[model samples]
Target: MPYKARVYVTLRASVLDPAGTAVQKAIQEQMNVEIQSVRIGKFIEIFLDSPDQTKAHQTIQQICEQFLANPVIEDFCFELDEIPRVSNLASQG
Candidate 1:
C-alpha cells in the first residue's frame, strides 16, 4: 500500500527565528503596527509504499531524523494516511 506523510518542522521555542523576526520588524516598520511575536516553520509531504502502517511510520520517522529536520534546534511532528486502493472491478460494478 502507498502511504502519504506530512512532516512539520519548527524551531525550538528557546531558539530565535531571525527570519521571522526580520519579517515581523519589516511589517511593523512599513505597516506601522506592533506585533507581539512571529514564528516560522516548514511542512513537507512524502509518499511511499509500505506493507503496513507501522513500517510506514518508522520509515518516515527515520527520514525525519536523518535529514528532514535538525534535532538540535528544531522539533518535528508527522502524520500518515494510507492510500485507498482502487479496483477496476469496482468501477465496472
Candidate 2:
C-alpha cells in the first residue's frame, strides 16, 4: 500500500520570524486589526510506497530531519494516510 504524508515545517519558538512579523504589521495598519503574533511555515506533501506503517513513519522522520526541515531552528511534524488505489474500471462511466 502507498501512503501520503503531509509535512509542516515551522520556526522554533526561540527563533524569530521576520516575515510573519511583517505580515502582522501590515494587517494591523491596513485592516485596523491588531494581531499579537503570526508565524509562517511550509507545507510539503509526499507519497510513498510501503506496506509497513512503522517503516514508512521512520523513513518520513529521517527525511524530515535530514532534508525537509532544519533541526536547529525549525520544528517539523507530519501526518500520514493510506491512499486507496482505484482501478481504471472504477473511473469509467
Per-model TM-score versus the true fold = 0.85, 0.92
Candidate 1 worst ten-residue window by lDDT: 33-42
Off by over 4 Å in 2: none
**Residue 91 error for model 1, in Å?**
6.8
How well is each residue in 54-78 modelled by candidate 2, as lDDT tens digits?
A: 8999999999999989989999999
Model 1, runs deviating above 4 Å:
32-34, 89-93
Q: Rate the local accuracy (lDDT) of all candidates.
A: 0.96, 0.94
Best by lDDT: 1
Q: How many collisions per candidate?
A: 0, 0
Q: For model 1, which pairs clash?
A: none
What's the distance in Å from true for residue 37, model 2?
0.7
